[model samples]
Target: MKLAPLHAAKAAIESMSGDQVLHTVDGHAFIPMDDVWVVATPSGPASFNFNNLPGASPELRQQIKDVCRALLVSAAPSRASQALTAYRVLIRFLAEEMPGRAVEMISLRDVLRYGASLKAKELYKLRRLKEHLLLWVDLGIGGLDDDLLIRLPDLETKHHEVGAAVRTLDPETGPLTDMEYENLLSAIRNAFTEGKLTTSNYTLLMLAITLGARPLQLAMLKCGDFTVSARQDNSKIFILQVTRIKQGKGIRPRTIFRPRELAPALGTLIQQQCDEAREWAVAHDVAPEVAPIFLSDRSSINMGDIGLRGHHSGKSMAEKLRRLLKDLAVTSHRTGRKLHLFQSRIRRTLGTRAAAEGHSASVIADLLDHSWIDSSLIYVETRPAMMERIDKALALQLAPVAQAFAGTLVMRQDTDRGRIIHTATRSQLESVGTCGKHDYCRLAAPLACYTCTFFNPWLDAPHESLLDSLLQEREILANTADLRIAAVNDLTILAVADLVRKCGEMVGRATK
Candidate 1:
């Protein structure tokens, strides 16, 4: 099809079923050709040979030329600006890359080959750009419904490598050794003392560590969102009302209480940074609009070089975090202890520490802004080795009681004394302070159970039942197919049963 005639191109596009064909550009339907004008580069003017060219208006074409020139100048003339240079290179490539046998056709295989040559992270980015360009083809330039025509070679292996490359690009977490943890603390303290990090970043880092917040969410934090006040008794408390989150219901803000550990450091950090920014703004005589709370000191340090004072953006804040880790030589505390510089690593560390400390999983999930509880559970899930240790400890503590009632115990006891028996059991339990009825118990005099009489019968009954229950539970547990959880439970249950039996015998003999 030699490009459809100008009037025919417009008619073909306009005639397409439904709103799918919004307009036509060149010979492509659904393209808003009139919205833009192409300034033919001398390198490849033949790219514009579509019959329905809709001829560019002189003024619009001039504007496009001006835009192209301005972009070229601003991008600088260096190897570092290759991507910017590629904007022009790509325009030229498109002329020839387009399928010669078909109008408005581009070689997806070549695009994929070109994309594959770039790094995995870069390839993902280009794919997004490709998607954007397709959108523009549909909306910006009136174009035919040719989305299905665009194709790329299969990337079966590339799909798997993409994930690995993402991890390489940014490792979210690894263990943190004691020294590294302390070093992070030290850097933060020094930054605060020297006014090197602003209060916003300090509070933000603390909040990020405490709540596992993202950079965008941190950037969006407003001063009014902080609720600093005192209780009826005048005790001070500061609450951060997180108004926006990424993972949960859209716009469903969740508030996380500031940990007591961070309360002392937070207010001072915020005020120190805010005060410094205000002072800097006044000193430089710069407009306040650009000075956000997290602006860096680099611009303040070199205010004389630029016409307008430099200010920080969200991108700069992320870069600053990378710089901090680089300066500190911070590494993931794993095998080889490889250095990590990504902001996601920082968030993960915060979450991992919280999980290790026994905070509620739901709270951790909220802090991390995880959409699923299972994702948050990963932080606290005990590994097989750790679970084995827990099993050993539980068994060791319950051994004696289980041994005493090894055979004579019953799994269920009818101690109904109408007392809501509730399946009484006397497993070797960890001491959690006096039972709720401790003060009122008539058997407070408890040196020898036989002599006291109050501690023997009831204790032995429950003790026997507990041992029997544990043994039965262990027997059932042994049938578990998985080696980790079931094995641990089996060993732990058997140990507890033995301890219960031992405790039962001890009480029975005391009574005898």
Candidate 2:
């Protein structure tokens, strides 16, 4: 039997009855021809021919085809796609570089030499080739020799090392900065306000920034996915329910809230989408129901002469976003690199902000719908703003204790309530009477004591002068102190001034 040319094999597969072909696990039909396999696609049958492989024998080629068939049947769609590409890459290498050499006879050294010949960008394909070969051996489809498996060089470690080095050396690529984010928001708002942006583009950009949903998630959203609730106060709450697409199996949907201020805009966009969907349905003589929110203007699928409209794909959404960014002239400040606003980056930015705002790891994971909390760590790691916020929070919490230790305030235990402490400095303790509710007061000492009716100021406590000093100090600190710590200083100043006022009253009463 003679092997047919690649085109002839493809044509033969195309002519075969679909019922006669074997179906992959994904339910796609495929037909085997000589030493090649052809899988049916929407466009037509795609051929995977190994007859021209440099070192592969007829038997080895059949084994490769068997593995391809197994993958198509068992692997997920993304993995199946990768396997197909890997098969083609391996065949190309064998046919062009190692002509006439049997694949099974090729040593580990030969594989290494082949890898060395590939450029950096093509290095990932070599990894995929090794992965497919290993899978084939594991599945016992190829009956590959043990020596071939043992000699297969471990390229993963080297690949990772090189990748890390490249990332470190070229660290210019990163998330948007504060100013850049503000500028982007401004540009988007201005464009939307000016009617320059379409309803679809405006809604997509706003949702990307506010909800941080994945492109596929946004594309998959339907008009019914959003629920708006009205409160008694007349304010409305918008909730968007997103279906997770990337997770392989059995993942629950996630719900996110839209900012209250965006409610009006979101409502308008939803109304517009529904109106368009209804118009399309009416034009096509189809009953209108809840349909895709982001409908594609161009139909990719044929429905006779009627032409069926479907939801926009992730690729299409990304392209639309890119065009918007290009029109806005958004660019990175650090490297002056042209900015490509990706959905993933928007998600990262939101995750980082959530972490900075003191949300827990579990909360971040839940918000992002990550399977593991560790995955959320990537967004929060080494962010200086988050660290600073944490530090400031810690400092504020400890401010009272620090003041007490420095002799600026005092703490006295209330035996009646073991946890309650009466706060007053040595001077205040001598001048003012002890607070009656000190046993119940949970507030920081001195300040709360000053405003209490139990407070009695000493006649010679120099109350007027103390009030002047406190007012001056408060004004100075208010002007110079960091905003984060200024509130703590303000509280102390208010407490001391109240104590001084009470003392002045007592002094005046003594003189009378």
Q: What does candidate 1's lDDT look like per residue over 365-451, in tens digits?
A: 777666667666666663112222223335545444222111222222423222111233355442111122223334322111111
Whole-model lDDT per candidate: 0.40, 0.52
RMSD to true structure for each model, in Å: 18.7, 16.9
lDDT of 1: 0.40
Question: Candidate 2 residues 221-285, lDDT tens each?
Answer: 66566667878998776656676644532121223322223467677676677678777767866
The segments of candidate 1 whose C-alpha lies over 4 angstroms from its true place after superposition are: 1-134, 137-140, 143-179, 186-208, 216-225, 241-262, 275-291, 297-311, 329-339, 354-365, 370-512
Q: Which stretches of model 2 miss by more than 4 angstroms?
A: 1-62, 91-97, 102-131, 134-139, 147-172, 229-235, 248-264, 282-290, 301-309, 331-338, 384-512
Clashes of 2: 8
Residue 106, candidate 2: alpha-carbon lDDT: 40
